[model samples]
Target chain A: MNETIQHLLNHRSIRKFKPHQLDQETIEILVRSAQAASTSSYQQAYAIVGVEEENLKQQLVEVASGQTYVADNSYFFVFCIDYHKHVLAAELASGSVDQTVETTEALIVGAVDAGLAAQNLVVAAESLGYGTVYIGSLRNDAAKVSELLELPSHVVPLFGVAVGIPDQQPGKKPRLPMDAVFHRNTYTDDDTMRQLLSQYEKETSSYYGERTDGRRTEGWVNQMAASMKDPKRTYLRHFLQEKHLSRD
Target chain B: MNETIQHLLNHRSIRKFKPHQLDQETIEILVRSAQAASTSSYQQAYAIVGVEEENLKQQLVEVASGQTYVADNSYFFVFCIDYHKHVLAAELASGSVDQTVETTEALIVGAVDAGLAAQNLVVAAESLGYGTVYIGSLRNDAAKVSELLELPSHVVPLFGVAVGIPDQQPGKKPRLPMDAVFHRNTYTDDDTMRQLLSQYEKETSSYYGERTDGRRTEGWVNQMAASMKDPKRTYLRHFLQEKHLSRD
Candidate 1:
């Protein structure tokens, strides 16, 4: 395999980080790499907010439900679904986009745009010998995050990425089987999917058991079921609507 | 800049592609790279469907509004936000996830998962000297695309990526100014955003004029305003809800 593919295969989330900070030039390179990602319809419907202030990072830590890494990382970035710029563009062109900006399609586009950019940033940071972890816990209290960041209408925080020098080497979590996630021509039938998942559960159970010295032997299916049994972030829809997104 | 960063900066979407099809090994490497992307809560809420059959590719081309490249590319992959495996997992654990899977938060997670994975696949393909273009037009008739792919419940097609040997070297589309997209500590004020956008409009207008030899000189703001004045894909929400996603 090539070095790039090898690097991708070696990815693992690093939670603990050293005290080192990224230089301005490295930060610029990461952000520019993110900007190079593909945007839908050339509507770059996302923004990156860099948080370096101690107080602001602490507030974000609380919003992330006490994830200290939010504040401990060398750098933290909040990826947001930002249509406020589009609103400004509309005003300048003497046009109204109220109807369009509030659609569910718009929300999906923003989320996808933000996600694409964030992944690019993560990849770039990893290539530069930095460790990164996606702080999806920001969604635990997205409204608090939005308020803390002073986000405007049509702008919402989706997630964050914390990058720094690695202080811990985390094991790579095994993913689902190739046959399970990669379908050929069409989606696999339910029976075939179930068989593939059953096979995967055994593999995952072994992985967890070995990793935790037999303390955590639960398989992928059980873990997924437990998490799926309870709804999470139920207020997200209402919050998006309140922010004038996905109102339709 | 590192080689990876330079590669990312040189990205440009290719609409035309050579007739060469990718070998199975290359496809496996690309998909495996995608699977390595981070997933929120390790949900892995997405799947990739490879389209190699000429007939199916033709059907997808029709779904994407007659974009011939959808069929002409060396390979096409439909990235889907898939929770069908989660449903199966719930069944295996004797638990129910219907309530959780229908929530807006679930939809957003799935979209992000799909987008992250798609971006990784794109980056891997480009590193391997392949040209790629994202086909958001698949959403133009998502239902038809879904039906053609035989997708199941809790699975929705977000977008497609057409990858192949380079047949054309397209100019890079200029993105927004760094100040416009990258905020510090908090969202930028409206006045600063307006100024940055005005500056960007001039650059974009000049870009379009030079590219088309003065035939297409519209600025970014005008283009955005015109596209945003009327909503597109009003049927997406209804379609997603019908697929048992984001119903809540």
Candidate 2:
């Protein structure tokens, strides 16, 4: 396999990092690489905020539901789905914000663009031998994160990435088997899903047992059932609405 | 400096592909690399449908608004934000579907996961000297696309990817200046955004003028203004609502 493919296939989320700071040049390269990612209609509907202030990082730790890595990583970046800039740019060209910015499709586009750029940034960091983990829990307290980052309307904090030199190497987590996650021509039916889950349960049960030294025995399904017992981040609907990202 | 970084920085979406088919092994590696992408909370909340049948590809081309590349590529994969499998697995574990499957945050997580996996797949393909482009236009007629693919509820089509051997090399698109998109400590204020837009407008105008042989002259802001005048893909709101993806 080629080096890039090998590097990509070896990806594992790292939550613990050593006390090493990334140089400015490295951060610049990573951000540039992120910008090189394709944007829908060249809208570039995203912006990144790099946080290094000790107090701010500490606050972010709480905002991210006590993910200590938020404060400990060499760098922490919050990727925002930014339509505010596009609004300003459009108004500068014309006299008002484009009507499109108010659509649900625009919201999805912004979020997807942010995801694309963030993944590229993650791969760039990994290629440099730096460890990275995405903090989706950043949404655990989205309003606070936005306030801490001085975000404007039409900009939502989608996720954060903590980048640093690795202090702990997490084992590669198991995914659904290839045939299970990938379908042919059409989506697999319920019968196929049931069969795939039965086999996957066995593999993941063994995987979790090995990783946790038997402290955790719940298979993937059981764990998902427990964690998702209730709806999560339901506030996001109102949050996006307040940001004027929902339907007009 | 590394090959991975260089390859990433050199990305350009290719719409034309040579008449070559990817062997099964290569497709496996690509999907494996995609699965390695970090998902939100191990939700694995995405699925890919590979399409090679001529009739299905032709339908997808129409669904994607006559994007010929959807049919011309060696392999086309539709990436969906899938919670259908999760619902089934959760039901198996707890004897009922979790309430979490119906929230906006859940939808966002699934889309982000799909985007993350798709980007990894693209990078992997690039490393192996292949070209790929994301078909966000897949959302233009998402309901039809889902019906064609037999997608179940809670499994929304996010986008498609057309992968193949490169038949044409498009010039790399320019992005916003680094300081413009990458903020430190907090997001930049309006003044900075205005200044950055001015400079970017000049650069992009020149880019468009050169590429189009001076036939078209809309700068980035003007183009955005024109495109956003009327909301495109307005049907998505109703589609998501019908699919039970939107909040009631």
Candidate 3:
């Protein structure tokens, strides 16, 4: 493998970080790298809010269900599906985008755009000897996050990334089997998918077992089944509508 | 900037590609790199379908509104938000994830997972000297594209990435100004946003004017207003509900 691919494969979410702050120059470079990702139809429908204030970070930690790393990082960035700029541009031209910006299609575009850019930022940070973790729990209270970030209508905070120098090393989580996730000309049939999942369950069960010294041995399927028993962030729909996004 | 950051900042979508097919080993490496990306809650809820058959590629090109590069590339991959494996696992465990898998939150999770993985694949491909472009036009005919791939329920194709050796050089598209897209501590207020956008409009107008030899001189705001005047892919909401995703 090449150096870049090797760097990617070595990725593990770091929850504990040293108290070393990232310089402004490094943050700008990371943001620039994020901007370089491809956008749907050149609609760069996303924004990054850098949360530096200690009080703001504490509020975010609470919103993230007490994930202390949300505050104890060199820097934190909240990625948002922001089309407020489009609204501004439309207003500048004396036009209206309400017919489009409120559609579900636009929401998907913003989400994908933000995701692509955030991944680039994470990869770039890793290359610069930093560690990062994506905080999807930010969506647990999306409205609170938006309020904290003072996001206007048409701008919904999707997730956050905390970047800092690593204070702890974590084992890489085992992913689904390649055959299961990568198909050929068409999707693999159900029988083949079941077989692959069965194989992965055994692999993951062993992984957790060894990692926890037999304290945890649940297989992948069981974990998924348990996790999916209840819906998460069910308020996201209302939040999106309140933000004037995906209302249709 | 570091080598990785420089590589990212130099990105430009290449629509034309040489007639060279990627070997299976190289494709495997790309897929592996994608799998290494972060997934929400370890729910690797996405899949990649590599389309190599000429007939299938032709159909996809049709779905993509005759983007011929969809078929002329070394490899084409459809990134899909897939929860089929979860369904299977739930079935095996005598549990149900219908409540969770059908929620809008799950759709966001899958979309973000797929986007993160796809960006990693693109970045890795570029590092290996391959040019790539994202074909979001696949959403123009989402149902047809799903049928073409024989994708099962609870799986939605988000977009496609076309990868190949570069056959043409293209200039990087100027993105929104950093101040416009990147806010400090909180979302920037409207006056500042407007000022930043005005600055960006001038930069982009000049960019398009110079690139087209003065044939096209529209600014960013004008383009956004025009694009957003009408909704694109209005069928996506119905499509997602039909696929048993985001039904809530």
**Worst lDDT 10-window in candidate 3 chain A:** A1-10
Worst 10 residues of 1 chain B by lDDT: B1-10
lDDT of 2: 0.88
- Identify the superior model by lDDT, candidate 1 or candidate 3: 3
- DockQ of candidates 1 onward, in order? 0.89, 0.79, 0.90
Model 3, residue pairs in steric clash: none
Off by over 4 Å in 2: none
Stretches > 4 Å off in candidate 1: none
lDDT of 2 by residue, B83-178 (tens): 888888887886544468778798788878988999999999999999999999989889988998999988889899999999997898789888
Identify the candidate with maximal lDDT. Answer: 3
lDDT of 1 by residue, B87-192 (tens): 9989988998989999999999999999999999999999999999999999998898898889998899999999998888889989999989999999999999
Question: Per-residue lDDT for A98-128 in model 1, tens only?
Answer: 8998998998899999999999999999998
TM-score for chain A as predicted in candidate 1: 0.98
Residue B79, candidate 3: alpha-carbon lDDT: 98
